[model samples]
Target: MPAEQKSGAARALAELSDFSMKIARGQRMLDRVKDEHVQIATADKEIVFREDKTTLYRYKSTAERKVSVPVLVAYGQIGRYTMTDLQEDRSMLRNLLALGVDVYAVDWGSPSRSDRWLKFEDYVDVYLNDCIEFICREHGIEAINLLGICEGGVFSLCYAALNPERVKNLILTITPVDFHQDQAEGRVNHGLLNLWTRGMSDDDVDRLIEASGNLPGELTGYVFSQMTPGATLSKYNVGLLDTFDDEKKLLNFLRMEKWLADRPHHPGEAAKQLLINLYKNNEMIRGEFQLGERTVDLSDISMPVLNVYAKDDHIIPPKTTQALRDAVGTSDYQEIGLEGGHVGVFVSGKSQGVLAKGIVEWLSERDAPSARD
Candidate 1:
């Protein structure tokens, strides 16, 4: 054999040896991995406001200083807000704080059996406004910035529409608003949510929510797992075996798994409205989504808007979020398409850099005196 060929063969054999040893080591560590618990959402925060199961947390400025107006982060009630702060180094919350951005996040704490009757109106109208008003009052500002993700983005849109005077800028990520849009049009891939809900009737929605009181978190996790069944099985079966030797990679993967497995049950009344009113009837875009006595009009949100969606998002597909520009009342609306799947856009190291940098630049430019006044 040639000298180059011999060297190449030697290198390949070395890698194979390493791979085999790593898998063996990983297999031994498998049982021990069950006892490992990594803490999350470890940023410094104070309870600025609390009502029943809901609490709004204001993160202390870790940077030298912060923006004049604070930004409130509203995460989906379907899951814990801790995903944004997945770990110490990879947390979006910590990254934002390091960039001199004042941040607050709402925690719709895990609900109970008696809390079944809690409606969407309670979440959007009462709890949302309560937090917003408190933030504005505490900061001594008229209007502050609002950042919403997923179902929380829906709440931010409704709140901004209902009380435009309290929101200076609106930032939404991975929020599905226009549920009625044709699934096959302008999409890299058709959304599973659209397909799943399209066939579900009002009775079907009511039947599920009514029987269970709240939509079970386990069921939600199962549905998400089914989205990529092969990948799901591989994680527990083979994927971890291959990766377990790399401590950092294994830890991060396990952290994500921990979060995914900790899903929160959806409030029954809100789940019903989400399925029947928003998902089935597509009420949000049509100005039929009601909170209290009034329909939520997206056009009422006349503030600077930053809409972001992942191009490869299977849950809330890019087309679903990109449609916001047409319905929005603000001429200052902007859109950004990140190159990855939905959750990966936030937690993955490469995309987290892009997301944080994009947001910091977007908000920094608009952080003038006029933005608050």
Candidate 2:
């Protein structure tokens, strides 16, 4: 054979060998892997409180308690709180607990069609308030620190604003304050959710909720997948292939997939309020967003606020979260820009420590006797 043909043949043989090795490794991995190997949210915790579909959990940690006031972590109903405690090594909940923080997380359990009438008032006013009251009564303290993630951050803002006396310190992560900031800042890549919702009309939103009874998790997952179509494709293809040979990496991938697959249905009335009242009408920033009888005035939140946002967050948008600084009433407002995307803030190795540390230090500063009152 000619030299060119020989070189081509050698390249083909090398490719074939690499493919065969990958297949063998994948087969071995599949055979060895079990359901328990990919289990997520494995941190130990006991049920502290429960109401309807919501449950509050107090994490059991051997670390010395540093802060006197406990923290109630409220994650948005869109996704489960398990993302924070994804795994033993990559868990923000564990990271905080290891740092001597009294951590409590609220799990907004799966909502069914019967929960269609449930609104933000039920979440913020009823469920969240009950959890806070329970924590206060248990600790014999007037108030506790509040850590809100994503949509939960919005609920926190509403709660802190409405009942400022009940919240000692407020920490918001990857939360959207000004929903329209994306268009105002002219960021094409950011706030796809905001833009998509804005494109929707009031009638369209109502019709959606009416037809579906509640916003389906699968539908929301599809929408999220649509946000980054290429990445979504690459995640299961190139991403899965790369992890097939490595047990640890493969487990990590599976854990995340588990979390992603567990999106909960957002209640219909709440979904309508979120998509129309907040996203389209821009009511929250305007001090017009209503929860029950009270409007959520951002300026009413007088507590020391620590606003954390992911620098590369595409869903919430950096500007959308940063908008909280000026809108909030507190003079002691501080912002920490972490190095990651929306979910990466909790899952990324580099960010896990930074996020938990930032929260601990911020809480400790305000948690002092003088500040606590």
Candidate 3:
């Protein structure tokens, strides 16, 4: 055969294979999209309680235990807590519950135009304290274990610092204490936040809030994508392709996709404070930060703290999370390094046994009757 003819045949074969793969990929995406439609329709089954503004999720478990400890799960404000309950099999909430934990997750419910003026102080001093008190009061316990995720972990740290006596055990997962930009990727540029907020008045901020009625998820997702451009595109494509076959896997994949893409618009003033104090100024970890009238000094947090960090996390680098080891005053502190990225720490199978088990064991150890006495 002539070399030119042979080469042309090879290229044609490659093109046909690629076309087949594209068709398969399109069908998979459609299936996942359909799965998401069903999930949204049945979101109510997952809810346990709803008050005026807060929606709390109850994780049911049949595990028999000697001492049951109530846990308050605090997740990031930008995303919903359903990420922890992505699926029955891979759900962190279910996993914890199965370990004989009485878990109650906090859902801040979508913020409305009226909430745009809300500040960090409101979260740390008002909502967090109230939630802790409510859970303790309801359970007839003096204190409860607090497990915080991402920004929620930051909130937990502040809460523990302010009211250490109310927190029996503190578990911080993929939480960022050090806001050093050099160590982190996808960090919000304070300059950009300031630039965005400087020209805006209270009315303008209010208008943006009223227009969206809690910032739409699309806008927040875009900001996150900008943090790691290539990784976001490449990794998710790989993930979607990898889980294309199994329906159960596909459901979990789509749920995480919905949660990831469904970022909420944080209230402008509150976001402004977070960007300035943490991202721009790096104050919270520095002990110079003040939330309302209360000061946030890690040294004031003397309760038992369990710090877990995702080794491959880029958004909140391991170093950034690990900084809590030195920053906190808790003499009983333990840091465990997990083999996964930010999202992987919760979703990846590698995390199921290690990270999830670590959480159960740590809480059990801390809540042991002897440990308290």
Candidate 4:
């Protein structure tokens, strides 16, 4: 071989070796990630209280309750409630369970072509209300506490407004109230997005729902990615490469990945109304929204309310959630600001101590009954 050609071949082999090493590092990270599944198996006594259109997982505390109140776990239709229980040690459910709170989570199952015809009213009127009634009946109690997270928080707020008599207390975490807030400043203007998204008719959304039993995770993932173009890509790149060697870090990343991909389809009409009323028109805050046959007036809720938000939340701005104090009739309301973004409010180490501690403390205060009442 020529001397120059021999040198060139040697350089090429070195470059190939470098690329191979990089690939090996990434594969090793994936292997470590898979090994640490952090299974969030609940120790509290559990039973499926209801299984129909929506399944309700009921968890009871063995510790005697000075106040035997039930907490309904309402989460977004697009994702699983397990994000609250993403890891064993980091689980909100486990924390609440240890606090001796009776818990029931509503699992909105995967919808089918037959379910495409179901409307938002069906969810509010039939499913949610039924779940409330079921819990109340099972315990022979007049009311139950409502713990709403993200979209579920919105649902719980509406439910509390509609059926004030049935709510013992309301807990809203990272719940968006005002949709008209400006998005140019890094906040998600759900109202504007809703305005644009609702242009798709209920039927149009239904077709997507019908075509795929549970809406494809890829489609939802794409929409979320589009919401923040550069930031998401950079974060994923960093997460994959930076934590490639740390076993625990890799598992945390993998768990988050699994939760992000485990999205469920939003019920067609419910999704449409969400975009139109809550996101587009900002009707919930405006007192113009109706749940089932009940006209929801936020002021109707007389129960103790604890509204929590993340200070650095871009998805739902603090201003968006801050209006709750003014909207509700309860004088015993409190607002807590935790340090983190929307997702971080529950998952991050900083928030776990601050936000979680504040929530449990707030619940404790209202746990006691007033002598006047």
TM-scores, all candidates, are: 0.91, 0.97, 0.82, 0.82
Q: Can you write out model 2's per-residue Cα lDDT over 90-109, one digit (the tens) per residue?
A: 99999999999888999889
Kindly list the per-residue Cα lDDT of model 1 for residues 48-145, writing each as its tens digit: 88999999999988887546678899998677889999988788888889888989999999987778988888988899889988987776788888
**Candidate 4 lDDT, tens digit per residue, 1-373?**
9999999999999989876786688787665544336453344545565545688888666555534577888887766787887776667776677666777888777765556556656766678889988888777777888889988888888888878888888999988887765353454433334334546665665566557653565677777766666767887776566666566776777777777877776765576567667776788889988765667789988999999888877667787788888999999998888887778877775655565456667777777432212
List candidate 2 stretches off by more than 4 Å.
Answer: 369-373
* Ranking of all candidate structures by their lDDT, best first: 2, 1, 4, 3
The alpha-carbon deviation from the true structure for residue 180 of candidate 3, after best TM-score superposition, in angstroms, is 1.6
Expressed as tens digits, the lDDT of each residue in 1-373 for candidate 3 is: 9999999999999999886786687586665465435253122224655654667665555576523668889987777777776665566776776677778888777776678777777777777777777777667777888999988898899899989888889999988787763334444432232234444665565565567555555666776676666767886677666666565566666766667766666766676566566766678777888887778999988989999988777667777788888888888999999887777888677677677678888877777431231
RMSD of each: 3.7, 1.6, 4.6, 4.8
lDDT of 2: 0.90
Misplaced by over 4 Å in model 1 are 1-20, 28-37, 186-189, 369-373
Residue range with the least summed lDDT across 10 consecutive positions in model 4: 187-196
By lDDT, the best candidate is 2
lDDT of every predicted structure (CA atoms):
0.84, 0.90, 0.73, 0.73
Model 2 clash pairs are none
User: Which residue pairs clash in candidate 3?
Assistant: none
Which one wins by lDDT: 1 or 4?
Answer: 1
Residue pair clashes in candidate 1: none
